[model samples]
Target: MSTSDAVTTQSPALSSEDRSARIAVTVFPLLILAAFAIAMITPDTFKPLAPGVNWALGVIMFGMGLTLTLPDFGLIVKRPLPVLVGVVAQYLIMPLVGWALCYVFGLPDAVAVGVILVGCAPGGTASNVISYLAKADVALSVTMTSISTLLAPLMTPLLTAWLVGNRMPVDGAAMDILLMVLAPVLGGFIVRFVAGKFVEKILPLLPWISVFGICYVLLVVVSGSVNKILTSGALIIAVVICHNLLGYLFG
Candidate 1:
C-alpha cells in the first residue's frame, strides 16, 4: 500500500478509540446517577450483589494492569520533574482540599470520611483514557497514575489516618489498599510482563470489562446505603461535585 493508504487505513481505528474514550467520559457521570436512582428505587435488588463487590473491583484493577507495559514507567525517567510534580500534587493538594471542604461544609462524618478517602486515593486508570482523548501526554498520565498507585499503600493509609482519623477510626487502611489496589495491579502487571502478546490480543476488551465491573460495584455500594441516599443523595452529589471541581482547580 502507498503511504497515504497506510495512514488512511490506520486513522479510522485510532479515531474510533479516541471517540469512544470521549464518549465514556461524558457518559460515566450520567451512568453513576442512573445507578444511584436504580439503587434508591430498588435497594434489595442490588443488595444481593454486595458480596461480589470486591471481585468486581479486582477485575477493574486487573484490567488496568493489562493495559500497562513496562516501557510506560520509563516516562518517569524521561521526564522526572513533571512526573514528580504530578505525583506530589495528586497526594498532597487533593487531600488538603478534601479536608478543607469537609470542614467548610460541615459534612456528616460518614460523608466526610468518603470525601477524604477519595482525596487520598491515587490517580485512576481512567485518567489515562481521558488524557488520550484530550490529546494530552498519555505517557505522563500513565506514569503519574502508576507511581501514585504504587504509593497508595503508604500514602493513602497514612493520609487517611492523619486527616480523617480524628472523626473516625481508619483501621486497616493499609490492608484495604493492599487488597484493593496493590495486589491485583501487581498481579496484572506480572501477567502482562509474562504474556504481553496474549494480553495485547485482549486489550481492546479490557476497558469494557472495567466499565462493567465498576458499574456493578457502584450498584452494590449504593444499594447498601439506599436509605441514606434517598434522604441525602442531593447533598452528597453536591459535595462530590465540589470535591471534584476543587480538586481539579487545586491541582
Candidate 2:
C-alpha cells in the first residue's frame, strides 16, 4: 500500500469497534427511556437498589477512566483554554439558563428548587461515556467534570442561595463524591497502566457495559420518585426538557 493508503485506511478490528460505539450511542437513549418505563411501572422492584446509585455511578466512571492514559492529563494541561471555557459553561451558563426556565415556566417552589439544584450541580459522569461514544475528547470531558465537581460544593450552595433563597447542604458531599467519582476514576487509571494491552482489548466492551449500567442507574433513580414523577404535571416535564436541551444547545 502507498503511504496515503496506509494513512487513510483503518484496520478491520478498528472499524468493528467504531461500529459498536456508534450502535451504543444510537441505542443509549432508548434503553434509558425503557428504564424509565420500568421504573414507572414497577418502582418498588428497583427501590432496594437505591442505596447503591452512587456506587453504580462510580463503576461507570471507572470504566471511563480505564480508557484514559497519562497523556490525556497532559492534553488538558497543554490546552487549558478550552478546559476553562467548558468549566465556565458548565457552571455559569447551565445554572442561569435553568433558573430562567424556572421563572418563565412559573414552576412551583419545590419544583423550581429541584430544577435549580440540578442546574447548579456539577457535570454528570454520564457525559464522559457519551463523549467517548461520540469519539469526542473524553479526557476533556473528564477534566471538565472533575473541575465542576470540585467547585460544586461551593458553587451549588451559592447559586441556590442566590436563585432560590435557600442554601443547599455543602457538608460531606465532597468526600462522598470523591469516593464515587474521583477515587474510582484514579483506581481505573492505575489498573489500566498496569494492564495496558488487556485494557485496550476491552475498551470496545466498555460502551456496552455503560449502556446497561446507565439504564440501571436511571431505573433506580426514577423508581425512588415514581409517585412524584407521576404527580408532576406536564408543565414541569416541559420545563425540564427545555432546560436539558437548551443547556446542550447553548453550551
Candidate 3:
C-alpha cells in the first residue's frame, strides 16, 4: 500500500492509551459525585467508612505507582531544578491560597480546615493527564506528582499543622500518613513489577478501579456529612465549590 493510503487509513480519534488515560483522569471525581448522590438518596445504605475511604485513596495512589517506571524518577534526578520548582510551587501555592481565601471569606473553622486539607494535598495523578491534554510538560507534571505524593507523608501533616493549628488538632505523624498513603502505592508498584506482562494487559482496567475507589471515598465523606449538609446545604456546597476551584487554580 502507498504511504499516503496508509496515512489516510489511520484513525484520527483518540488512541487506546489516550482513552484509558482520560478515563483514569475522570473516574475518581465521577465516583465521588456518584457516592455523594447515593449517600444523599439512601443514607442507611451509605454509612461513612472513614478508614475505608483512606484505603480507597491508597488504592488509587497505588494504581498511580503501577503506571510508573524508574525512569520517572530519573527525570527528577537529571533535572532537579524544574522538579523542585514544581514541587515548591505545588506545596506553597495551594495551601497559602486556601488560607488566604479562608481568611478573606471568613469561612468557619471546620470549613476552613477542609479547604486546607484539599489544598495541602499533593498534585494528584490526574494532573499528568491534564498536563498532557494542555500540551504542557507531562514529565514535569508526573514528576511533581510523584515527588509531592512521596513527600505527602511529611508535607501534608506539616502544612496542615501549620495552617490549621489554631482551627483544629493537627496530627503531626508523618509515619501514619506514610503508612496510609505510600504503603499501598509501593505495594502496587511491586505488584506491577512482578506481574509485568499481566499488568500491561490489564492496565486498561486501572481507570475503572481508580474511579470506584474515588467514589467510595466521596460516599464516605458525604454520608458522614449528610446531616450537616441537610441543615446547611448552601454553605456546604459553597465551601466544596470554592475548595475545588481553588485547588485547580493554584494547583
Using lDDT as the measure, which candidate wins? 2
lDDT of each: 0.75, 0.85, 0.71
Q: What is the lDDT of candidate 2?
A: 0.85
| lDDT of model number 1 | 0.75
Encode model 1's per-residue lDDT on 172-231: one tens digit a residue.
Answer: 654664566557767888899999898877765665666566677778888898777669
Error of 3 at 240 (Å): 3.4
Ranked by TM-score, the better of candidates 1 and 2 is 2
**Native-to-model Cα distance after best TM-score fit, residue 9 in candidate 3, in Å:** 6.8
Please, what are the lDDT tens digits per residue for candidate 2 over residues 1-251? 99999977856555666778899999988888898988999989999998888877888999988988999899889989999999899888878998999889888898889899888888877888789888789889988888888887888889888989876667887667756778878888999999999998888788887788888899998888777877884777798889989988998
Off by over 4 Å in 2: 1-13
Model 3 poorest ten-residue lDDT run: 166-175
Q: Give one digit per residue, the lDDT tens place, for model 3 in 1-251.
A: 99999999998988565687676565545656667789888876667367686667777777666766567667768889998888998889888888887887788887788788888888764564345434356556666776787788778878988999853344554445556555765676688778878777876766677666666766777777788789868875776677668756765
Ranked by lDDT, the better of candidates 2 and 3 is 2
Q: What TM-scores do the predictions have? A: 0.76, 0.91, 0.74
Query: Stretches of candidate 1 above 4 Å error?
Result: 1-26, 108-114, 121-170
